[model samples]
Target: MSSAVATVPGAEHAGVSLLRGDGVITSYTPSSSTVSEVDRLQSTYREGPCVTALWDQHTVVVDDLVAEADRWPRFAPEAAARGILSMLSFQLFTRDDSLGALNLYSSVRKRFDLDSQMLGGLFASQAALVLAGAQESVRLHRALATRDVIGQAKGILIERFGVDAETAFTMLVHSSQNTNLKLVDVARWLVQGRDRPVSS
Candidate 1:
């Protein structure tokens, strides 16, 4: 965010917005409290340059929020009241499913120019890659942890019930279905000794 403010002319503050897998929007690395407030407004209103860039276009440059009041009826007035007049937002992802947006804010009308847009776009691309990689790492780590727990659960079932590996797995699946719990949850329960006998 500091780099964005330094590199992008007329950008007084910067923040990153992320759309989580659960469909919630979150803010990260806000340059200041004012930037955080702006991001919160965007999330609450669901209508702003950052939201528009994330959902519709690759880039959204608002030279003056007052002039674009009709575009974002609820968000524009609120943001302007906070002393933000111009904004430049770039979609972080280039793919069909967007990750989020990188937003730059300014207090002066028509603050951002063509040069600012170009620089911000480049920064957004790099930020997108970093965010994607981090997300993938977290997913992989969770998958590995789940696999290990399930394996331990299967071992316990095999030893206790004198069943083969496949049979133990089937028993776990049956218990998951009977209880309407997730397979992972069933396995975790057995591993933790919360449940002894498999339903099947």
Candidate 2:
């Protein structure tokens, strides 16, 4: 994905960053020294075009870093020091459950024009699709694991208390609610607890 953006006419550097639902940057790609520095600054200070793009769910274009000093107090100066004169950040994905950004940087001001924005946006959409697919795969895997653990927990309850399946499930649910933990967590606890010897 970074390579795709790097091919843009005036693009000097490009990076794709994934942000967790809480707005913390989780991962980024194509490790260039300067680009990695910029990514780190944004994640550390929590300000920059990329951060804005992720939060607002839109593209953020900076024509000149020097001119945008007030907008991003700490980021603008640091980015300029690294010879980044301009940047374009597209919101790669923004859903209730996910967020991500694709950022392009250049040494010359106004490097990304309309055509570049459109092409970058297209790339961003592709990134979004990939992120969404990956997230879904993770969700499905967790769901399967949860089901397996919960089933084991239910079986244990049934054998120990001589209860029906529905009653055993209810017990799990009650435990989950009482502890304020997820049903899956509660079920996992029950399964692991069996390994411990009962106290005399």
Candidate 3:
């Protein structure tokens, strides 16, 4: 993400973040304290060009945060207070399953013009590919971890209750459905419970 954003023509301070479905920032590049704070404010307040781009699944260009009061009522004022006069945000990946956004900020108003916008778009496309690879890696890691934990949980159930593998799995599923929790959470709970010190 950092490398992809670095090549942009005039982007002085750039940041990339992976946002969750509910608009929570999961991962981010701390380009600088100021840029980091700006990104934080956006996520904390749930308003900003980045947040808008994520929701609308399109590039959001704010030539001047001070002049964009009507667009982002809360964010524009706060961003201006932080000396962020201009910003450009591009949604990484497609609208259907957007991962997050790549954002560029400037202290000068109207800093991101037509040429800058074009370069930013090109940079964003490259960033999307990198983000997709990173997301897939995370997904694969989580899947493997879930599988391991579930296996451990099934083993514990089998040993403790003298049940077969299928029965142990069924018990886990039943617990999951009853508690309205994910199978992974249920399995994790079972494993943790098994590892706890037994009371006399």
Give the top-scoring candidate (TM-score). 1
How many clashes in each candidate?
A: 0, 0, 0
In model 2, the Cα lDDT at residue 74 comes to: 95
lDDT of 3 by residue, 1-200 (tens): 45534666556678876676655764477577777888888878878888888778578878889988887788889989988998888888643444678898888888888888888998888878877888789889999999999999889888988889999898889888887889888899889885642111
Q: Give candidate 1's whole-model lDDT.
A: 0.88
Candidate 2 local lDDT, 44-115, one digit each (tens): 888999889988749998999998879899999999998999899998766676678888889999999998
Report how far residue 50 has shifted in candidate 1, in Å.
0.9
Top-down TM-score ranking: 1, 2, 3
What is residue 112's positional error in candidate 1, in angstroms? 1.0
TM-score of candidate 2 to 2 decimals: 0.84
Off by over 4 Å in 3: 1-6, 25-27, 94-99, 178-181, 193-200
lDDT comparing candidate 3 with the true structure: 0.79
Model 1: residues >4 Å from true position, as ranges? 94-98
- For each candidate, what TM-score against the reference? 0.92, 0.84, 0.81
lDDT by residue for model 1 over 1-200, one digit each (tens)?
A: 89999989999999999876655668888999998898889888889998899889989999999887899999999999999999999988744343678999999999988999889888888888888888778779999999998899899989998999999899989999999999999999988887556876
